[model samples]
Target: MSYGPLPKRIDPRKLAEREVRFESSVDVDQLPRLVECLALPDGKIEVDLQFSVDEQRIRTIVGSARGDLHMACQRCLEPVEVEVAATFNLAIAASEEAAKQLPRYYDPLIVEDEEIELLPVLEEELILSLPMVPYHQDCSIQTSFGDDAGAVDADGAESASEKPNPFSVLAKLKGQ
Candidate 1:
């Protein structure tokens, strides 16, 4: 089936009763906020969502979103490809007030008009899941200061003469 634009507004009540399932792909360009951080935002994001009612008769949305984004590495300022993914279990609340009482396990999704926009929701989750500073898992930058100044010596050895004898302080205190 041709997956077109994902639904903007989702009616939680009907979706919960019918236990609807949704699977779609959205182009990277469609999510403007997410694109701003990317060095290359050329791929499509996959979204898989399911709507159902819980044992407490509360409407819920359970889903995951996944995609790859090229972000500037904070350390090297080079393009570093990273995976952005989020798995969410959310309770659909009728009002902003109702959302406050939601349990910690379920993040509250407030629906003022009884409908929620899917695009922003998905975009937000992916954005929040991203690292604050995107960088390679194993970055190869040199990280050290000199022994006399910052890190150990070039020979990876610190001579005994370099270290102040611990007993020297005690000798001074004794005035001997």
Candidate 2:
């Protein structure tokens, strides 16, 4: 099914009161912070959000974001395709005190002027979902620095290195 453009800002409390369910796709270009981490910032994020008042009588937003992103591979230093996704349970809070008082299960979305910027919140969720060191499962590049066989003698015994240890000089100086 087709979805409309995402609204830039939203009043969470009002939306929860009305029990709104919002679904949309937003271009990656709209979220600068999320784009900065990507190898190629050319993708669309699919968002689904349901606003309602939970049993605790607190206004809440239950949402998920999904996207195909390209992040630089740490092993090969090339663009690697990655799937990013996140689900969030957020409680609307009017102030810092209210935010701190929220339950552990709900992340606080502190609102000012009864509205919050939607793009940044969504961007944060995507960013948090990204891998710290993204890389392909089987990278094409060979990352081995030295052959293990070369470090062993013909009899399959470990051999001392032919190169002198740089730390040996420090040890000699300490002995003197």
Candidate 3:
């Protein structure tokens, strides 16, 4: 059965005991928080994760997710394909205090009332793993930061042409 964007929360302890491995993808459009940041929202995250119990009986999750995202290239101002991947080794925590006490090797994935919010949890990880400023590895883009930055209005009026640099005064105040 398809496993992702799971309709229900999973009991980590039981899954850990069973050694259940979930392989699935959640549609990007299905997650609003995730979709908003995407230039192209019709995509999916490939999830290949599993649950297991550690020697200390601590429930753990280990997995990686890979996917393609369309983000505006910081250098080109054009759509660029970004291959995003994130690997997580997490130990489930029973309480806020317990999360802090988790070992340095394993990040804590907080679980409350015996359940977890799977989508946002994973989405947050993937999102955090994304590059703060994404760009093409090799691209030919000529960007201009000079006077040509003048903007035009819908009626074809040159708004920035000879406009007394309104924000320029702010620079003067900084020295005072």
Most accurate candidate by TM-score: 2
Evaluated at residue 124, the lDDT of candidate 2 is 93
The residue-by-residue lDDT of candidate 1 on 48-115, one tens digit each, is: 88889999888898999998889998666788998889999989888778988887899998887867
| Candidates 2 and 3 compared by TM-score, better number | 2
Off by over 4 Å in 1: 1-4, 143-176
Model 3 clash pairs? none
- Sort by lDDT, best first: what order? 2, 1, 3
TM-score per candidate? 0.77, 0.80, 0.75
Candidate ordering by TM-score (highest first) = 2, 1, 3
Instruction: Give Cα-based local distance difference scores for all models.
Output: 0.81, 0.86, 0.79
Candidate with better lDDT, 1 vs 2: 2
RMSD of 2: 5.9
Model 3 spans > 4 angstroms off: 1-7, 147-176
Model 2, CA-based lDDT: 0.86
Query: Per-residue lDDT for 54-143 in model 3, tens only?
Result: 898788999998899888888767878888899999998988899898888999987877776677777888888888888777766644
Q: Candidate 2 — which residues are off by over 4 angstroms?
A: 144-176
lDDT of 1 at 31: 90
